[model samples]
Target: MTLPYGRDDDSAAYHYINAALRGRDAEAWRLLAADSHVEQTDRVLRAMLDRIAVARTHRTAERATARARAAAGEITQAEYQRDAAEDATKASKTAHFETLLREHHRQIAQAARRLRGDDVRDELTDLVLALGAAVDAHRSAVLAAGYEPTPADEALWARLGELDVPDTDEGRTSVEDLVRRHAERQDDLGRVLAGIILDVAGAATSVPRSALLTEWKKTVAPTLAPEQKTEFAAKGKGSLATERLRKTMGHLERKGLVKRSPDGQRLDLLDRAGLADVADGRE
Candidate 1:
């Protein structure tokens, strides 16, 4: 029989399911089941059934008593349904974690097989450490900005924890691919930030770094949080809003967004239209 979840391949179903389970929103669950793939639906249901079977096997006497009560209408159908749903959620988490564990083991084994010597192992270790450091830096920035991670973000971090560098050609190739992907994402973010800087540049030929920080806090910060303020004023290095903006402006300057004055004060905006276009999501 066709399962309800197999109805569509849209990612919305996954989000709906996460929201439904976390928030206990029955309507969201119903909507997700109605629109998602039948196969996906069956997987979850089967998982639930498998869990129940294991429980029954362990508690045969209790199961018998419960069955008798259920048959005699001592347990309402609504109550049974709720219990089953909870069992299914337990199964779902078990399966999710099991998959991640299996994948991690598989990757570790493959990496070891590919790099069969101490020298290879060391090289792989260095590469993996570099990748992990980059990811950690980004995570720190995200946290410093007071942003909360979603479930997907946490899952990604979990997967990254499993990364290993193998000495084989395939392993090196994978590392190279990851590096390229990281660069691309950084470039994209830089472009977006440059656009925002340009929008604030305005009629002034040059903007001071301090002014940029003030304008940014006033403009962009509100869109994210209600009582929006940057935590750039701490004690250490790069610990002020102006310092953060200065670093950002340096990146933009390299990207041709602005030019540094000869006296090393204020930035002269160049290619204003290009920055505005990126800001407006036009090009």
Candidate 2:
């Protein structure tokens, strides 16, 4: 016999059973069962349809719950990984800065050894003090630039005070100007540093080594003491100038004042400190 929508009777029954199993209208099956000539067969079909409906409902609910749990687990895992990465980065930066500080101390000690004509101990102490002042000025610039000062940073500033570099009007003006300039350039410098760090952290990191060195020299040149500035200018001839410039740039690079691009020719400006930070080795 033909059924609704011109389908044969058997096909109509099959469609009704499928609708019930898929969680569609179960009442349609009941209406179909009422009109069937085979009473016993119709009753069996109705029972099977009811069971399928119930099973479908339960299965759908279970699947939904499982999906929610999986999503939450994924979020938690991602957060953990991000935190771990940040911690490792902080540790590495701290280690690098400490190494720079030690080298600075070593340089002062060597200078003291070379100048044996004076009271060597006093001279060494004075040089260390000067270094400390330079570090302090640099720290002030960092803080002014919105960076949190670490304990090591604080110690460096304190050591600068211990070094009896006379706080002349000119010195004060230079240091204050350096702080202001650094603060102004903080955001730009931060972006550059972030880019550098991201590249270094990536699988195929490659940046031009010399670019950082050149930028460091440029950043610090304006802040150096008159004598040091003269010395640097005088040495900037032929190969000697290149070597001195490289050394100066290297010093600034260690202090985080400059960033290098991947190509090595492009030196990106990262920070600004008046002549003081550069002169004091705080750049």
Candidate 3:
């Protein structure tokens, strides 16, 4: 229908089409260009179908690597299990995509052979129509597999801007460090508690759970702009923030910046300066 896209569009379709046009499959252009039906069928429609397949393939490879790493004990079994479930969902979606994808491939190959003047069975319209229904589903599956965000991550990311956290340069470098803890440990509450715990500790060498929580309820909770204190503060017996703080503190200790007492009564900041950098989202 039209020439392959230039460098401006980074869409997988454009890139795939361009690659086919300029590379080994250049001959495909002539075959597709021969008939209006062929050209239209193999253009954007083909690109969409192929892009979904490619995306699903890349996701499969990434999950394979994660599986290998989990087997070697490079990541926790719990983390692995969570990821495995997500991957299974992706794989299931991919299986559905593959069914439609293979059908389209069969149809296109038949079209190509027919273009070569060979008698080949084909059903372009029916196959294309079926693909429309599956397109959104395929996109959702690929996107979820690509990013791998949990519900906590999505909420925290939204709240980060709402809370105006890291209040430093509005850039990825700082925010990524804030979430990642300088590539040390990352979890559900890990994204937020770094700053809250730091603010609670102030210049104290040691902080107990009671003192830390008291400061959180009285001091930090008041300063926050957002009204979602339920996740960030304990009201009566226990809270999400309470458990998150406990886990985040354990993460801090593993980073070698904090130490927990034998009885878990108090925690000592071992590396104050480094901890500051960690909490502030700095290198």
What C-alpha lDDT, on a 0 to 100 scale, does residue 173 get in candidate 1?
39
- Candidates ranked by lDDT, best first? 3, 1, 2
Better of 2 and 3 by lDDT: 3
lDDT of 1 by residue, 1-283 (tens): 3323434543544444444445755454444334233334333433433444466456556556666777889998777667667766866876665444333323333333334453455566667756665666666677889999878767656555455445334544344445555455445555656655665666766677566667765654444321111111111233343443555566567657688778766678787876676566564
lDDT of 1 at 100: 44
Q: Can you write out model 3's per-residue Cα lDDT over 121-198, one digit (the tens) per residue?
A: 114322432343244334457567897766765664454333322222453332333433423444333434555557
Of candidate 2, the 10-residue stretch with the lowest lDDT total is: 229-238
lDDT of 2 at 159: 50
Report lDDT (Cα) of residue 166, candidate 3. Answer: 24
TM-score of 1: 0.31
Model 1: which residue pairs collide? Answer: 3-38, 5-36, 5-37, 5-38, 6-37, 6-38, 7-37
Residue pairs in steric clash, candidate 2?
Answer: 129-163, 132-160, 133-160, 178-274, 222-275, 223-275
State how far residue 227 of model 2 sits from its true place (Å).
Answer: 10
- Candidate 3 deviant stretches above 4 angstroms: 1-192, 196-202, 217-237
Question: Which 10-residue span in candidate 3 carries the lowest summed lDDT?
Answer: 227-236
